[model samples]
Target: MNTSLKTILTASVASLFPLGAAQASEPATSGQPDTVLIQAKKISAPNVDGTSQAAALSASSDSAALLRDVPGVSLYGAGGVSSLPAIHGLADDRLRTQVDGMNLISACANHMNPPLSYIDPSHIGSIQVLNGIGPVSNGGDSIGGTIRVNSPDPEFAMAGEMLRKGQAGAFYRSNGHAHGVNLNATHASDAWSINYAGSLSEAGNIVAASPFKVVSQGNGGKPGLAGDVIGSSAYKSENQSLQMAIRNASQLLELKLGLQNIPYQGFPNQRMDMTGNRSEQLNLRYKGDYAWGQLEARLYHEHTRHSMNFGDDKQFWYGNAPGMPMDTEGKNSGTLLRAGLPLSERDQLNLGIEYQRYRMNDWWSASGTGMMMAPGTFVNIADGQRDRFGMFVEWEANWNPNWFSQIGLRAERVSMNSGPVAGYNAMAYGNPASPLSVPGAFNAANRQRADHNLDFTAVARYTPDSSFSIDGGYAMKTRSPNLYERYTWATSNTMVMNMNNWYGDGNGYAGNLNLKPEIAHTLSATFDWHSANPDQWQFKIAPYYTDVHDYIDAVPCSAASKICPGRKDGFLNLSLSNQNARLYGMDVSASALLLSTEKYGQFLGNAVLNFLHARNKDTGSGLYNIMPLNAKLSLTQHLGHWNTTAEIQMAAAKTDISAVRREMTTPGYTLLNLRSSYTWKQWRFDAGIDNLFNRFYRNPLGGAYLGQGATMGQGVPSGIVVPGMGRSLYAGMQLKF
Candidate 1:
């Protein structure tokens, strides 16, 4: 790593230790660096900082892939940038993800524009993952966890001085013919400062390993196999942001504006691809310190216009399916206020209020020559709207040096409404007298729904000495269904519910009006052991369990229902519902200095292990798309201005799968990766080769291969497992001034 990058990594690792006892003292100076911490009080939850984020972004083009190695966290591959993250088998809307204190909603029905895709990796200052458990004040309406991505803080010059700084970098990769560039510049004065960042990236179809092949049957009854390419997996995107900050004696105010444009992107797992995406965002924030304590307030808004349609690959699969063009628009706005107060010498309290409003519409245009009509069909989710308001209070106390505890409570109200819906051949499934005519009845009735939910958390830490500690927590979390989950109104039997296809099961589905909220009860514990010196060696282990009531699932629909069109795969029609579920998992990690010498420098070793088990308790069936047991081991060496690392990643075969969904099984494989860096003055260079051995493997959670370019053997199933990437070489250079 470069000297500057090495400094950042060191600082991030040091932050994992206890603040007062582990941090080294620094000499007072006239100029100080800008820093921001975003946790609620002191809690005993397992969390991972941004070190992994920095490493992953440096090596790959997708930001969501960064979480795959984090303990207790896994990824559901959907596209290059739209991968959905899962914790303990829960994913998508079940988790809360925010960028710079703003929550962004995806406008595409297939979720082509997830929250993480809105922020470029070059502008990310920090990323924090609260695994399994999170403070009530930080988030609500989530049972999984929270992911926070923050931009670099604005900087102001010291008294009687002005400062200017900037950095430029570029990178290229082989397997996908991918390349990208990023630039950042900032100017600061005594009272005001300005900052700007921009990035551009593009990639072609990804190449699979040589041993991995896609067998397809052509229109002529001839079967053919293709090698080393997953077609239609291309994308291009651009992002830009500007920020301004004003500072006074004890207060600071900041404003930011961001713009994003994505002309096209392919999804190998979804039925439709992203043809266009344009978005704009504005945010305003204030931070102040007073006699009572500290206060932070923020207001933000985001708007997105997205379009999706069948790409060339898809057009080849379904030749005369008509040009299915769909357009969607979304508007999101929110406000937050939080304050901290000191009650006494040993007690403190934090309180916050939050509110958000969201609106969305989805409609599709006909090809002018389709099966039933000439003009078009509308109302996938006409005039869909959701509003939420929440309040939370938390208290932290230090009974003594060895014992610290925190307790918090949160309450929220969620409301949803939508206008009338209509589709092609509505009358076929819309008979009002039929018991299965919910879709038709919903269109006739004005739909309005509301839910009141509550959550609580209690955590404590016990430490007898500086080298060891025991921490534990218990939490109750709740989440109501999203707008799409309750308001997707389409009568086409073959219209697979794309929003709910995160698992890539290749099943058609529809929404339910009577679905209830999911409530989760969880308990977690962690044990930490470290050397007395606090810098040589360390080990940490965490175990967690959760039981959820009314967990979301899919079940067979009645044959007479309007949406019960059978698919080509011969699977029965399905609808969303709630069932009881259980999940338990454990994470183990360790790091140590193996050797140190003045002549050879330092050598370090690190390892991690993760395992999880999930099941639908009510039906005695395994959960879909759960990650198999996995582990990773790595070694690092530093000498003079050069740094190098070697790593091995391994996973066990997965057989446990949901019978109803007909989930596929995968065989295990191991991979090797190597990376190195060199720095000189203000210039740095990095190079790495992933999958060094050119190994061919299948990722159990990688989702099914729905790409149209590939052909399958006659009578072969459609749910073929997608293969991992082939060997690739990457190089990057950065210059700072």
Candidate 2:
């Protein structure tokens, strides 16, 4: 440990106890507690409000990064904007993410446009994370948790009066020379209101400063030289949205339109980078209050166009390789309707129906001569479609003040189909008589597939006293495979296999048509302890376990199938299959008020710990890309209009990894972070320094390093792990009027 870092930590901890006794008798804050609670599933759920949102926005522009502080949540970084979030060790498409009640699907084969990337943090008004257990009304196509993000609520003025308000904010960071700006404006009258929000952000290449030695055999043997600046990691993007609302005596209607454009963005983990992306979305909703009950209806549609290719640093690796550019287009639309009714004085019933349809096409254009047997060849998924219809019913009961319970059930029907796929010059590729050329057999074998899925959930909470509570939940969840998992036809050519690179494992993959839907059974429990005083101390611990039947995994392809391409290296060409798996984890969090006084202000301390264990039931192998045991601790101080925070993040060495996937181990390390903010009138200022000591380390779940610098002939180790970001200083300011 660094001496300066030790001194700062000791001084901060030593100064708190002396004032603890004196402040215990002092009064608390002047207003209500700074916690907002929402009633959902017959329980009180905490809401991430404006203050927390502001702090998150000031830290990073990526929306997924904001969830890192949440218990039972972890991140798998692939690029500056394409980081995937995981819950209980399930990640990527396994989790359901909804923005403003719209289900947005990724348009790129490499998953460059995740659901969270659709909205900027500046436009988010509230976020709710339903940890492993969620209501059936949200969605049924995923076994993991659900994340719901909502835009700001519309404002209304008094009768015969009008109101206008606006806000502007900007932030800049030194690590990648990243900068961004956001603006929002609104006007409201008694019956109608309109609002607009927009943002723009850009960043240069990131520099890795970790000094850890490289242990992988693939990267060139330059031991400590793998942490140099990563190439093709720059990006720029813009987003805008408009919302209109109208209200009568007992009914409200709203319409929203959103647009996004990204000229270029690079991925350090995948084989290709995003050259361009453009998207548009429209959403409409109606809410009414009637004597019978409450009614709500919603409809939404989204379209996206995405393109990918090699970046400047990697273009030479191919040296004029033809058919270099790949493109994808996607359209997603859905409708939802729900009603709430009171069955009795102590019971309530809620019913809802949802429908979603997704269409996608992936194709690559050939460039240069002598590369393709024909003039133009497109070797990717074509005209792929997946549709889902779901209905759910939930019952909530308040048996007594000490007991609250909820039970829900959902049914979903999923159907998938795709057009015929073809490979270039069938005869030249050694499959002249086979269906590899036109893929006619492939189309006929998997033309249309359908699955009927069901889900059930039961949860209860017991409060023995005002300061103690216990919650327990059990759920049975199911998920159908995505389009790419079932429609990507196999090919002997490795180039075609490499096109389906979503996991960043540096291996080729093909889809399987005979895959079964994954089913998961989960049980979770939480224990909470709090002081009678609201501002004193609180602690919570949650433990969860999940058993997955037919879990998706990669398996080796047989030579007779002609689907596996022979690679000179030891890596194997694999395809998707179903296997059994089990996962268990625990999340612990605690917060305490160390001091509170009229003269000295307030001081608080917080800590969080997360652990996970996942394994394949049949093979007894650890799951790939599982997060290591990690913990975070922070101290916060507030005086007058100024606030400051000091944080320490630590992770244990990862020794349990998937041997089949050739996963590497990472050493444990610690990082320090600092932040401060000040407020005056309608303006606020924020500043922060991340990786304060500039300690160098690699994240266990950051994925493998696939940049050109790590290539076999590039001078650096070919299999070096991706390193974490270097030290960074950032500042921001916001004004509201």
Candidate 3:
């Protein structure tokens, strides 16, 4: 490694340590440098201050929390630190998450660790969410949008002269017992910089609602919402990140690597005796100034290994879940490269190429691992893999100083290899009476393959002046059948119902080798107006419509018992499907500096409103689990050494739940949060209370899953509801030398 690179890595590593203990005596003049503000795209937003002033307050926030304030954005908060950002009524695989221009897919099926889990909040230098009008350099097929998180990268004029030498800092935070410590640090030199961040959170029964109450027909057919088993329900999750960058007169290069591991004793759905996951990622990039304009290039690779098991004690309780008996493993790998160049004063170009692969395996233990079935009874229902490669290019030319048009095209090639892997299908036959009832042995020779995919997009923007602009675009996108959607033949416990459900098979769920990718054509427009002087005020409004063909939905199949005569209750099953969908929605957001310190008391106020309306013609039901109209308001007071903030959030009632499933309506509810900090020059103390009111209400989607017995004669309903959290408190302190 080059000495500069070594120095870079070292600085980032040091940031991982607890540096608050070290003091230089005098207060550091500069805390963090100001970043070049990118136009706040609806897709990505980065919060610089400790509080989420410009965004909606979130219970669980990752690097992408900055965009919560953007119009038409909602987050699925699974825990206190894990969340998935949704945009324009789209989320999950539709939205892409990038760290330093790299993608790190979480390994868990429940999505415990989303894109934001890879970095520590303290180490983030800046974040940008390209909610709408996504830059072509980010590639295509992102219906929701993309989020970008950049580390500390700065340039010095003298090259070797240090107008101000960037220094390193670190801090650690720990909660009560079972709570693990989190550490992070960073250092910046005149020409380059490095940073490291990590966290270890081990907690038992995350403090639940006080005097908790249970509904008679709550989750898992359990009597009452059982008080957490305290020590029995425990979890441990950790993340470590290392990043280094070199900056010269006109060039910049960076490399990043990261790893994370998580293990838990019990989760809500699963009978959970134990479950764990491991993930890794690496990325590299180079950027330099060219005579015509600027040039940027980047490459990345990522892999994730996920293994989970339900202890024997409870393994038999939940029927036919995939990877049951504690030995299921899933893997994913991908690589991507992107480049951009400014062709001329009035034109620019961005292009990218990317590849991705995914695989899953199910094996039984050799020893008597508590299974009634024979040992070593391994079955490979998902002997499937997909290789997807895509290249996209965009050209931008200004018709006038204030008006410009952008056109983009993307071509993709997707090759799939799917079928039984020799002994894979035959083994499942042993379970003649179980849901693992394979129709018949499939020959490895019966494998199938498919190829060819292309997408297109065109956009135009007109800016009459610095204060007003409007933009819109048209795009066509497609999605192929995933491994689980096509080749899965075994029972799984990870779907809407916690049963040994088959994704698709000869039964109600049939695989269509001839299935075509879902195609969508979309169009949208945005209007923005802003004023920076005097009291700051900015506002943006967007409207969009999309029509999709061959859209897939997991509709009910034939009776599960009909396929497998020996099976008990009809097992849950779905097949390769298609439908037609048309959607339209609007997003509006605005922010203003209600008060300025120079003219009035040291106080600030901000508020945001987010709304969405979606429909599914196939089901004639509103998009499943779509959040209704919601809004958040916050106020902050700043004094010499103290800053205090309070926030209120409101969620509107929602009547949209998939039919076969009775939609549980969520009455409107309100929540309050408070936080404050005292800064004494080099050191700062922080504290906050979440859900200060201890209000009790369940999220519209909480446990809103199809129950295993919904198809049985049992009185159980189609969807189950999980309650939200009660009041909670947290505090931390930071120091700078």
**Against the true structure, what is every candidate's RMSD?**
6.3, 6.6, 10.5
Q: Count the backbone clashes (under 3 Å) in each candidate.
A: 4, 8, 19
**Most lDDT-accurate candidate:** 2
Error of 3 at 223 (Å): 15
lDDT for each of the candidates? 0.73, 0.75, 0.52
Q: 228-271 in candidate 2: lDDT tens per residue?
A: 66655778889899999999989999999999998888887766
Better of 1 and 3 by lDDT: 1
| TM-score for all models, in order of appearance | 0.90, 0.91, 0.78
Q: What is the C-alpha local distance difference test score of candidate 1?
A: 0.73
* Ranking 2 against 3 by lDDT, winner: 2
Q: On residues 1-737, what C-alpha lDDT tens digit does candidate 1 reach at each position?
A: 24465445445544553321211111111111111123344573454421342334457666666566566778887767667778777888788888889877777666778898887777777566775568887768888877777888888899889979888888888888889988888899989999998988888878777745445443334333355666458888889999999999999999999999988888776667788899999999999999999999999999999998766555433334455678889999999999999899889999999999999998776545544322446557888888889999999999899888888899999899987766543453344334356556777665788999998988888876676667779999999988777777554545534433434666656777777899999888877666677557666778889999999887665522434655565333567788889999888877777777889967777777888899989778888889899898877777877778888989899888887777788999999998877767776677888999988888788766766542211232466777788898988766777
| Candidate order by decreasing TM-score | 2, 1, 3
The TM-score that candidate 2 achieves is 0.91
